[model samples]
Target: MMNDTTFETLPGRRRSDVVYKTLLDRLYSGQYARFSRLPTERELTEEFDVSRPVIRNALAKLRDNGLIRSVQGSGSIVLYEHARGDDASAGQVSIGDFQKCFEFRVLVEQEAAFLAAKHCDRAALDVIRQNIDEVDRYVQRGEYRIGKSFDFHRAIAMASENPFIVQALDRVQDFIGFKIYIARSMSLPNPVERLALINGEHSAILSLIERREGEEARALMRSHIERARDLFLGCLPLEVVSDREGR
Candidate 1:
C-alpha cells in the first residue's frame, strides 16, 4: 500500500493531476508491476484525502495514457509493460532474448546461490532476508513489487563474494526484470497468490543459504529460475517463444 504521506500538496497543481503523476511514477518505477491491481478507489481517497471523483479522474487519465485498464467490479489493472527509457523509440527486446536471459540466470544465479551458501556472512544474508520481507509487505498489499524481487536476486549474487558473478548478473538485470513483470501480469485475478508463492521460494532458498547448504541451495535456485522462465514464456505467443522447451 502507498503511504499516506506519499501524496504532496503541489502549489497550483490540480489534485487529480498530482495524483495521476504520482501514480504514474509508481507504475513506471515498478512499485506497481504490470497487471497488478492499483489500490481501490476508496483506499486512494483515504490515502490522498481527496474526493472519490478526483481519484476516478486520475484513474481515467491513467487509462487514457495506456497505463491501466478498468475491470468491472475488479478495479484498475496496470498495463504499463516495460520500464521507461530515454527515448520513445527504444527498441523492444525479442521474446527469445527474454528466455535466454532466464537461461543465463538459471546457470549463473544457481551457482551464485551455491557460492553464497558457503561464503555469505551474516551481514550479507541479512540483506537478502530484508529484500524478502519487503516483497512480503508488497504482496500483502496486492502489489507485485518487482524492484525488490530483483534486489533479492542481486543480493544473493553479492553474497556469493564473487564480483565477476555480480557483474554478469547485472548485464541481464533489465531483461530479467521485464520477465518478472510479464509473469506477474499473466497471473492476474490471482497475482497475490503467485507472488506469495515466489516469495515463499525466496524464503526457502534463504533458509538453505543460511544453513550453509550449498548444493541444496543451488538446486532450489535452478528450479526457481526455471519455473519462472516457463511461467513467463507461457504468456507469450507461440512463435515469440524461441526455446524448444518453452514451446
Candidate 2:
C-alpha cells in the first residue's frame, strides 16, 4: 500500500532498495507462498517500471537472504520458510565471534552516544524517547517488540549527528535484531530489565548531552554496551561454543 511519493523520497541510490523492501513485504505477507514461482524478470520489470538490473538486484537480495531461490530453467521460486531452515535451528554464534562483534559495536556506539549528547536536538531526543516508550508499552503487553527497539538505537545514532555513525549503526541494526530475537526465543528472563537498562542508559546519555558532558557520557555508554554484551552472551546455552560458524 505504499504510494509513489513514498518511493520517490528515498535517499541515496536507493530506488532499488525500495523495490527490494516492497518485494520482501509482499513475500512475508503471503502474496507469494512457498514454492510459488514468481513472475518472469521481464514481467517484474514492467510491473515496477524499473530496469532489468534493478529487478535483478532486488531478486538477488531476496536469494541472498534465503527468502527465495532461482532455478536454471524455471523462474525464481518462493522459499518463505527457508529462513528458519528445516530443523528450526538458527545460525550458530560463537562466543568469540559474538564478543568480537559486540566489541566493535561498543567502540562505535559509545562514540555515537557521546556525539549524540553533544549534537542532538530536542526533536531527536523526543524521537528516541517516544521509541523507548513504545518498547515499554509493547513489552508490558507481552508483545514481541524488535523493530521499535532497534529504532530507539537508530534514533540515538542519528542524534549523534555523524553521518558515518548513523550509517554504521543502520547497517548493523539487522544483526542487533537477530541477537535480540535469539535472546527472546531462548526465553531469557528479565527481558524488560535488559530493555529498561538500555533506556536508562540512553536517558543518562541525553542528560550528559544536555549538560555538555560528552566524555563522561561516552564512557558510560561504553560500559553500558559492554555489560549488555556480557548479559546477552550469558543468556545463550554453553553449547554455543561448539556451534560456531553455525554448523
lDDT of each: 0.74, 0.66
Regions more than 4 Å wrong, model 2? 1-90, 139-147, 176-186, 238-247
TM-score of each: 0.60, 0.57
Per-residue lDDT of model 2, residues 1-247, tens digit only: 2347766576423666667667766764458877989989988877776678877877775665556789999999986632334333343445666677778778888888788878888898888778877767866754433435567667878889889988887566445334333323224565556556566676776677667788997898788777767777777656434344555
| Tens-place lDDT digits, model 1, residues 1-247 | 3344544454222677678768866774569978999999999988887878888877875774456889999999987764445433132345666766788889899999999999999999999999999989978766544445767888999999999999987777435345334433533445568778989999999999999999999999999989877776676554323242343
- Span of ten consecutive residues with least summed lDDT in model 2: 177-186
Q: Candidate 2's C-alpha lDDT?
A: 0.66
Write down the TM-score for model 2: 0.57
Query: Model 1 residue 19 lDDT?
Result: 81
As for candidate 2, its clashing pairs are 92-246
